[model samples]
Target: MHFSLPDIENMDHRFKVNFINSLSGFKSANLVGSIDKNDQHNLAIISSVFHLGADPALMGFINRPDSVERHTLSNIIETGFFTLNNVTQSMYKQAHQTSARYAKTESEFDETGLIPIFSNTIAAPYVEQSTVRIGLELVEQSQIKYNNTHLVIGKIVEVIVQDNVIQNDGYIDIEQLNTVAVSGLDNYHTTHRLERLAYAKSGVQPKPLII
Candidate 1:
């Protein structure tokens, strides 16, 4: 199954989108929470959230084109703060529902029956049902010239997770939290840890390093 540039470009729009999206493999599933000046809450499910840097604790996510009304993107721009809440096995249905287009005044929390939690550190709301919650402050945003999409980068200001999930080596066991992954546009998947390996070195095969 191979496709050239012309073949891909000529494919059906929906088929092309699904094919291209799935080619990237599993992506991190997160519920992006934001609020407008009026305190109107907005929630959205995004799969593109990715780590940018560790020193600054930076993260980034892609916002689809703003040709349509994008409440979550607008609210984040308005407030300069947002949250990335991990979608777990129990809450993925509600998390995916947040992707639906709703009126700016309508709160996805209310619409989807998901509880919203708040913190003193940032104004954005977090998913109370999520086991891993991260509050971030918007640091930079730029439009991708090729696709007209926007890349939103944020600095991690706060992380809410159970202490037991953190390993002694600074690794958080997301599998213990039942965090789910996304594939294509709507498929949700649970992952299994194959094995943790020691750092690779030249002329040396890595060995299992499970704690």
Candidate 2:
């Protein structure tokens, strides 16, 4: 299906949002945690984690202006700490429920009945049910005025992963975690590893192998 900006004028906001979100299906799923100045905790059910491939492991997520319930942007600015947790199929429902618009005083962790695990280094909490969790510290934040979205960039400081999920060669086997993928707003799906491609820049051709 082909879509154009003009076509959005005739479609409802919900449909447009779904259409755009589906385009991001190829990205990894992540749960972002932040704390407001009042010490109120906030969580963003994110599916995209943009990586910069640099030292300290920089990553980012875009927040929609209209959909953001808590002032997570301000919290990140003040605290410079956040956590990114990987969502699994077992926790998909609870993870998705974190997106609900609750009062700032309420914690999504409590509302969704998901366990919050305190980070060893950061003040923020991560989903205890997640197979993989990373503690992050804010490095930079940029606002995209046209889209009314904030781009949050952070450096990973700590990582926690299930032993079985990590392969001998240091590659993570996502399928073992039974991770869930998000498409659009309310749709969720599971993923499996198809193949593990060889390093193309190693100056040698290797046979492709399926995992």
Pick the TM-score winner: 1
Per-residue lDDT over 1-211 for candidate 1, one digit per residue giving the tens place of the 0 to 100 score: 8889999999999999899999998999999999999999888899999999999899999998752227878888999999999999998999988877888878999999999999999999999999999999999999999988999999999999999989999999999999999999899999999999988889987899866
Kindly report which residue pairs in candidate 2 clash with one another.
Answer: none
Off by over 4 Å in 2: 1-4, 201-206, 209-211
Q: What do the candidate models score in CA lDDT, each in turn?
A: 0.92, 0.79
For candidate 1, the 10 contiguous residues with the lowest summed lDDT are 65-74
Each candidate's root-mean-square deviation in Å? 1.3, 2.5
Please name the candidate that would achieve the greatest lDDT relative to the true structure.
Answer: 1
Instruction: Write down the TM-score of every candidate.
Output: 0.96, 0.88
CA lDDT for candidate 2 = 0.79
